[model samples]
Target: MSDAIVVIPTYNEIENIEAIIDAVFAQEKAFHVLVVDDNSPDGTHQKVIELQEKYPERLFLEVREAKTGLGTAYIHGFRWVLARDYEYIFEMDADFSHNPEDLVRLLAACQEDGFDVAIGSRYVKGVNVVNWPMNRVLMSYFASKYVRFITGIPIHDTTAGFICYRRKVLETIGLETIRFVGYAFQIELKFKAWKLGFKIKEVSVIFTDRTKGKSKMDSSIFSEAVFGIIKMKIRSMFTKTKPHA
Candidate 1:
């Protein structure tokens, strides 16, 4: 079996699933993919099943019952990957916003550069996002700034969904304790890893707005993140973090 796996959580992503799988497989390095689908009525799981026949060994699919939050989908995927022996694990979006080609760079950051977490950062190289509204651009940019000021992680894109993690980092972190299920989940994971003294490095990458399907962003997700960080920081203060080996 391959030592690296990319876990992409999906919900009604038919327009992009097949293409995303192909893009990842087209990479120079051999990496496996696991699509954790949350019961996409648009036959997304059926598409994955079809691909599995072609790339039987490299592709996988897990179909869930209902629409759960993004964080829960990833947490479920994390547990599935952890049960196996993958050394390098990744979190990517089904939408082409995150370039599949850059997965190699993320892997290198951890496999060669000694970083435990490698983020596919949009702001690491001065706001490299494309085709987003000016208002959204400002909100996302300032959101990272607010997160940095509050959490003090030194990361340029704190809510970035595209990331790669060494297996050991997940093993050290108590996965069951992860709380927030929105974008805040991203911050919580990074913050917990940082608080435990893990090395996280941001790899510069371009984030394009998805050209197909609808975006899942909503006001509630933004609100949860705005308030959740404070709770997470407070919990960290009261809780004793385990030492990294």
Candidate 2:
């Protein structure tokens, strides 16, 4: 198996499952995929099962009981892939919002450029998002800024889901301690990595809102990311910070 594995979490993403798997495989780099499907009612896992028949070794599946949070799905993927000898682990969406071509760049950031975490950031260069409403654009942009101000994490797109982690970073982060099941989970992971002095680099990429599948974002999840971050920050102040591995 290749050292790089892209872990994609799916929840009712049937519309985009097959196409996404195909796209990832089409890339020049030989990256394996681990789909942590939440048993999508629409048979997202079944589609992956069908595709796995053709590329059995490269494509892997982890069917979950029911719809769980995105954070937990990724955590499951992390543990599964970590058991193996893969050096680079990636977190990507089933939808087409994050371009598959950028996976090479993310890998390069870690393997070639010597960074611990590489983020396919939307705001790293500027607001390079398309098809999102103006309000949504502002909210997302400001949310990153808010997270930076409160948590003191130096990232342009704090809520970006498209990310790559070196094996050592995940091994050190104590995956069991990860909290927050919503978008805040993204921020928390980055924060913990930064606290431990992991080198993180942001690669500017345009985010095109998915046209096929429904969005997973909800008000409750959004609230957790917005207000919950302050609580996370306060807790961190009292707790002694751990050094990097």
lDDT of 1 by residue, 70-138 (tens): 999999899999988999999999999999999999999999999999999999999999999999999
Q: What pairs collide in candidate 1?
A: none
Write down the TM-score for model 2: 0.98
Q: Any idea what lDDT model 2 has? A: 0.93
Consecutive 10-residue window with the lowest summed lDDT within model 2:
236-245
* Residue-by-residue lDDT tens digits, candidate 2, 1-245: 79999999999899999999999999999999999999989999999999999888999999989877989888999999999999999999989999999999999999999999999999989799999999989989999999999988989999999999999999998899898977788999999899889999999999999999799988888799988899989988888877874
Q: What lDDT would each prediction earn against the true structure?
A: 0.93, 0.93
What's each prediction's TM-score?
Answer: 0.98, 0.98
So what's the TM-score on candidate 1? 0.98
